[model samples]
Target: MTYLFNQPSAFAAELIEGFVAANADKVRQVRGGVVRSTRSKAGTVAIVVGGGSGHYPAFAGLVGQGLAHGAAMGNLFASPSAQQIYNVAVAANNGGGVLLGFGNYAGDVLHFGQACERLRADGIPCELLPVTDDISSASVSEIEKRRGVAGDLAVFKVASAAAEAGHNLAEVFRLAQHANQRTRSFGVAFSGCTLPGATHPLFEVEKGHMALGMGIHGEPGIKDTLVPRADVLAEIFVDNLLSELPAGVAAAKGQRVAAILNGLGSVKYEELFVVYRRVAQLLASAGVTVVEPEVGEFVTSFNMAGASLTLMWLDDTLETLWHAPANAPAYRKGSVIVAEALSPAEREEPVQETLPEASAVSQQSAQRVLLLLEAMAQQIQSSAEELGRIDAVAGDGDHGIGMERGVLGAVAKAREVAARGAGAGTLLCRAADAWADQAGGTSGALWGVALTAIGTALGDQQEPDASRVATGVRHAREGIMHFGKAQPGDKTMVDVLVPFSDHLSQAVAQGASLSDAWQQAATVAHDAAQATAQLLPKMGRARPLAEKSLGTPDAGAISLALIVNTVGSLLHDKTPV
Candidate 1:
């Protein structure tokens, strides 16, 4: 979730600082996000550009030779305020005034309109050129409501160059709008994003499903569908975009054009390229030129899982800028038609699997515990919803559901080694690693703690029995409560923990044997779990669900109770617990 280059609120300013530090000779900041060249020719219409944050190379990156005259920067996914836009227009003014080129968003319109009004007050002429190239998949009744997307690049490049060449503001706006008219784009999303330090994701599509036509800021898409493979997905995306193009604009076999394959943050290039292959073929079949397209992340939307395709019908004038030599951190190009490529970017190293750090459990007994945990994981995998509903009474409705699925995933790896049956400690160690990686949240870590504690309880018991079972359950609860910071009265698993351990301990102390004590503990845990509703959440996720939990026990405590009862039931005469 962390933004790579700079902090959030400070990003716009730092990016400008870096831009000036690197290209002081080519561009200069004018006391705002706007940057201009000192030698901008007189009478040549100035191109004022801008947009929200995160799209590093787009609004700012394009502010170089043969591109924008200057750029007005804004916050993340937010439009530049009116004053910022006015500043850019004022600095870029050469008396002949400027052409303001930007994306078509409601916020952008509101801010830019005020900036234009302010400029008119100063007697400066200004024109607004908006890019609306996203061929919205919305139905006819909904088309007017769609937002602008990636096609802004080529269209702005064309618009900016027109101004740089001494074309009047009117003509520059004309060309920019023309580009918007000729260009079309569409996108789809799979998962969602997490702003830095966020504990949960901002949005969610569905398990194994994608929402086509989703916007950049976690907004809902036109529709959700089971994600198809790259080839089939490409056909759907490209075909939709093509249908919206003017009937014959790109229908000629040799009509030279360029295609931009954009990733919506965190999508891997290989997957993007796979989808592009379909786009390339689709364009070829329809008689459009793809022109050795660039395939990489351009404009991104945080960590959302999706991508968009923007195809611009190009002429020699637009094609020249597309081929122009340029280089910026996020976007790059070389005029050279042929050359040996530079060394490739480094790949991320795979994580090595090794035993985790834990001392309570030894390598032997841990393995047997691993077998038990894995078996339990499989049993709960399909019960996420059922458990979730049970927890709904006294805990977060998701506790049962999340735990069921989370443990199953963690067990997948743990079971593999356990199937061969190693000692308890070794298996527990492996299980701990898998649980943390796959389970992902507080519950996952707690499950791992339980596994390690079981290893500790099994200690030197060569042929473990009910006594070992009771000891392990007690130790496991201790670990969960210790690190989790939730107690019995706090409406957590401790509710059942206190009763379960006490029953088993007393039974053993009063001359009861392992079988009888284990059975008593199971019965105690179930009723105690149901009793959690008597307490209010004083800690953990259940606290939020506490008031709602009134009249019911915490789901986690209940779940802990269920798990212990199950484990205890397996302990019997002449059998290892």
Candidate 2:
């Protein structure tokens, strides 16, 4: 259904280019995303919000005077890489500090959290504000696990307003948290969305039936029922939200709230207004007051035929900030005093590092590493579609594309460094960085950790032998476990990685050659990956729809197995070690 695209991989980048060109007066393009064209006060808290690229108006469109200072844009339905988030935060930072706000999805959490640590290490004060507003994703008792949806707007607005009001980083973060606590959203979809160049939708709803509690990223709904009239749908929305008022709000009666009736991409404004009509009547009947209710798209999935209702229970402070003036490209509340635009020279430029000198033996090893990366890239490209199919059973179906992008980036970077006569360790490290930067998801971050750990274990000065290679692989496993926080039974990539690492280490310790040990370990990885089909996902986006993934191997685990197997073949055929 996404008819307009040059190439699937290039879609996100191209759209961002066009977006900046059209909104140049309001925002300017940065390395990873967009920042406000106008400069803010010297010591104000900078609000940097971001997520995957499909949700327009949510991210780049909200970068302006009274909204986000900048947004780290990622590939379609994938979180931006940690490097991307860091770049945006660095560019957006005023002298005070930076507040990173994003939906509480797994990928966003991993990438943003990493960026927060990096920012602090670079002497910049940074805090995280993950929005959890979707009531359908988790139980009230498990509110922290909820997925952020349309209600992100309310939290972003209030937090940005606090920053604009000259609040310090602590105050801004506190207000953001308060706003997140007060906001609740519920969404439904008439049909699923298709990514650009895809022949089919990620998931489909039965004809004449509508999905309830569907996610914005084309995730299938938890339940399905026959389509109902607009009034009935509105009633469903009101009843669900009112039944679970936030902890502070005793009841819906006499409560003043900001309501947002959001149309997810394909839903028209007219349809939303019709739904909002009944929503308003129901609220009034329940003695609840609606304050400046907005009835249109604020956040969206790319052309998903759905809508969501968000209620932000407003306190006095929240209400004042809600009513404050804002001027973004897509969202404008009231007139704002335009600030001076930033000149080209004021923007930050990316720093390039020079390649370090390497010994002849290490340079030869780097060539072998490049060959291994190229083979892995080819394997991932060939299997991407199948991997995506498996992921769509329960999670967002972008795993294949994400892996493909990541491996291709890694291969390209490896080739560049190997040509420059870099050592094996330095080449692998650079390739890992490129993979993470290009893919920008949970898998991307985890793979980056794995490769970096391996690179660190094998120093650039010498040719790594079988024992050293085994140690590097074991370290890779440890790093992945630490970074991803998933154990073997969690049905993630760790399921495969752990077994492979252990087997390889044991075999190498018993004096097996690197090629033989790797071949044996690849078999272990394959079995572990297949065994994941019987396990339930305990982490990431697949956790909520665990039942649906019952008979399918995890996409991440499968991809890791495929890569390791490819590497094993390469090692057996060519690499001396």
Most accurate candidate by TM-score? 2
Summarize candidate 2's per-residue lDDT along 1-577 as a digit string, tens digits. Answer: 9988998878999999999899998888888899888989999999999999998888998899999999999988888888889889998999899999999987888889888988999999999999999998888889998998999899999999999999999999999999999999999999878889989886678888889998887554579999999999999999999988998999888899999999989999999999999999999999999999998888989888889999999999999999998999999997799889888787547666698788899898888888888888999999999999999888878899889989899999898888888998899888987898888889998888778778777668899888888888888888777767898899999999889988999998898989999999999999999999999999987887899999999999999999999989888886663
lDDT of 1 by residue, 1-577 (tens): 6646445435556767777678655566664364544355677777788877666566776775556767877655556655567777787776777778777664466556656766988999888876776665335454444456777777876776677567887777787777776777888888877655446665678989988887675554678899898998889877887676543464556676678888887789999988988888888887778865877776677677888888887777667656765433344466422222212221112254354333333334445455557556655655556667766554334465447645765567666755554445556545654554344335555665676676556553354555675687688778667666667687776778878888987788777777678778879888888887677877543443357767765767767776776656555432234
lDDT of 2: 0.90
* Candidate 1 accuracy as TM-score: 0.54
Of candidate 1, the 10-residue stretch with the lowest lDDT total is 339-348
Q: Pick the candidate with the highest lDDT.
A: 2
